[model samples]
Target: MEIELVNCECCGLKEDCTQDYISEVKAKFDGKWLCGLCSEAVSDEVKRGKKSSFGMDEAVKAHMSFCGKFKSNPAVKVADGMRQMLRRRSGDLSSSSSKKFMRSAST
Candidate 1:
């Protein structure tokens, strides 16, 4: 029942989760806790790696390296955030502009 702040071993994402939840995640990721997204990615990697010699540990390490690369790039992170924001607001932006056009036309 106690909530604790925990950081994902792979991505360093912080989440306030119950102790039980943290333990569960750690147990799943070879005793290293991963965030939900990282865990899913690792799971997918494991499934795909079945064709080769890859396993859970390898997937976790590969994902950790991938996340670490992104952490070192501030510009990429900003650009990515802006891109996501624009994508989400695109519909609103378009509709608002159309409304402004209609109002001007009626005036």
Candidate 2:
């Protein structure tokens, strides 16, 4: 199978994938190619949209719009990722501390 470098429609992330794989991904995303992360985000959006009775096209458009906002600058994207990582780490630390506090209180 031949491999091709494909740019994601949402995040502009480039991935080397086989033509068959690329075709499969495009087929799943309403003919637009998305990277793995964007695809998962879109899939989640579709699930969330189901609760509001929105269709796949609307979900895709919403996700594309969200991604478009952040795709303009690489520095901004990196900073955003760092911010999210820090937030997750802080949350984990707080939860661990709370667990320790509970243990100490029980003892």
Candidate 3:
């Protein structure tokens, strides 16, 4: 039941988590702790690499490299964050409009 601060091995993002949760994450990622986003990215990489013989270690390394590039460039990270936010907002607007259009067409 102890809470500890864990730093993600990939992105270096620190998270406050219970000791049990930290142990679980480390166990899953080959004894390295990863934040939620990095873990998901690594999982996606593994799924995408299934046909190319990529293993968990390789996927983690690849994701670490990718995150390292952004970590060195603060401006790039900000720009990327803004871009993602806009893309998500736009997607929400589009989906709502599409639903309205479908309703109108049905009528």
Q: Can you give the TM-score per candidate against the true fold?
A: 0.74, 0.67, 0.68
Better of 1 and 2 by lDDT: 1
Residue-level error in angstroms, candidate 2, position 67: 1.1
For model 3, what is the C-alpha lDDT against the true structure? 0.86
TM-score of model 3 vs. true structure: 0.68
The TM-score leader among the candidates is 1
Clashes counted in candidate 3 amount to 0
Candidate 1, which segments miss by more than 4 Å at Cα? 72-97, 100-107
Q: Which stretches of candidate 2 lie over 4 Å from their true place?
A: 71-107
> What's the lDDT for all of these models?
0.86, 0.84, 0.86
Report the candidate with higher TM-score, 1 versus 2.
Answer: 1
For every candidate, C-alpha RMSD to the true structure in Å: 3.7, 6.1, 6.2
Which sections of candidate 3 miss by over 4 Å? 72-107
TM-score of model 2 relative to the true fold?
A: 0.67
Could you give candidate 2's per-residue lDDT for residues 6-67 as a string of tens digits? 98887788889999999999889889998887788889888887878887778789888888
Candidate 2 — number of clashing residue pairs? 0
Over 46-92, each residue of candidate 1 has an lDDT whose tens digit, in order, gives 99999998999999999988888874443346568999999879978
